[model samples]
Target: MTVEVLRYSAFPEDGAGGNPAGVVLGAASLSEPQMRAIAEAIGYSETAFLSPTSESDPARLRVRYFSPRAEVDFCGHATVASAVAIAERYGAGVLTLETNVGLVPVSTRHDGVELTATLTSPATWTRPAGDSAGEALDALRLAASDLDPAYPVHVAFAGNKHLVVGVRDRWTLDALDYDYGALERLMGREGWTTVHVFWAEDRHRFHARNAFPPGGVREDPATGAAAAAFGGYLRQLELVDVPSRIVVLQGRQMGAPSRLVVDLRPGSDTVEVTGTARRLTLTPYDDVDLP
Candidate 1:
């Protein structure tokens, strides 16, 4: 069967900015291994697979996420990319996705030249800070003083868990290097998606980076799942009031800059992340030979 993979840069205002994701429309026939291989072939951080599940049930649609190395429960960039692809093909509207994590809702629209998607994440949960922070610091060769006292560290989760570590200043956030093997081992043992390193410039603005050794990546330029988790982390810490929204800027240091906007509701426990997507060329997916 023929597969049309659209490339979209999620989270950035300009098409050039943001993380590039592959959207494979109509991926019903592709198997899990096939999807993983296709993602590896595409060489992006993550790619999305979409297939019709229940036309009678509007909320039923099969969605899968594949990193270059493995299949994951949830992926924000792929969701944004898929939503924009769907909006471009099926018109701007609300789309429901049935993912390995749970049901996710995404709304999309076309504003003349660009397409945008806002995804309401699955239920969120936060856990007390773990010892991984100090270990992470050891692996990165950093000190406790580098941490931002304003945002205490924690393991934040929406669909998956992420270690959220906010730094005290830009200098620390800029100086990033770590022992890849050690970090990867620790992340795998802890079931972490990424170690989200951040610096809050202000209430509405922040700079962030994700160490994604668990997924076999040095770092992710744009990380939507972590964004949602961090939003929860702030709320759990009572750092932000309810109904607050924040923008996260990532990948700038790496040169593939991205912008992610996260919205939080005071009484509710879910966070909404919004961003834009544009096309990137890649080999179309095929089950028989893969992409």
Candidate 2:
């Protein structure tokens, strides 16, 4: 049997920009090893493998995300790309994904030829990074003075854990340099998916760069999970007022600019991350041995 994987770029209106992800539909029979091999072969930061849950629940599907190096609990860009792919084949609407973290509800819409997907993340929370702040700064080769005092460093979680640090300026955010090995080790030990360093452009806008060392990617053009977690982080710290919609601009340094919108509701714990995705022609890979 042959499995098909579709390619798509998420969080950009242009087809060439944004984070590329692989989406595999009808993956119920594919084993964990097979999925990992497929994801590695695809060579994207993350790939999503989907399996239909039950005929009784057309809106629900089982989703798994894998990076080249390992399987992750959740991935935001892949989820958005996958939803657009599904909507293109079927129709634009709602989809419920059963992820390792929890059930996430996603809504899809098509505007002209562009498809946008919004996902409501699970309940979110944050914790102090403790001694990791020094390690994070050391790994990133940044001084404490480079940080934005407005937003303190914290380990935040929506669907996945991220170490969020606010940078003092966009220049510092753009000039991101890090020790990959050191960061990989630190993230592994702290169970962080990415180290998110951002600069607040204003109360409603921000710029971010994510270091995804554990995923084997030096940087992510667009990171949905990190954005969602940051929304929670902002709310918890009272950095932003509730019932607010914020925009995050990313990937300018890498030349693939991406835009992600995060919506937070007052008195509601869930955070919504929305972005557009463009489908790409799939590049074929050698067949993997399936058990």
TM-score winner: 2
**Hey, what RMSD does candidate 1 come out at?**
2.2
Candidate 2: clashing pairs of residues: none
Model 2 spans with C-alpha error above 4 angstroms: 13-16, 282-291
Write the residue-wise lDDT of candidate 2 on 1-291 in tens digits. 567888888998355578999999889999898899889988999999999999998779999999999999999999999999899889999999999999999999988877789999988998889899999999999999999988899999998999999989888987889999999999999999999899999998999999999999999999999999999999988889888999998888898899999999998888999998887665532344444
Cα miss at 117, model 2 (Å)?
A: 0.6
Q: Provide the overall lDDT of each model, using Cα atoms, as 2-decimal numbers.
A: 0.84, 0.91
Pairs that collide, model 1: 7-278, 7-279, 7-280, 8-278, 9-278, 243-266
Worst 10 residues of 1 by lDDT: 282-291
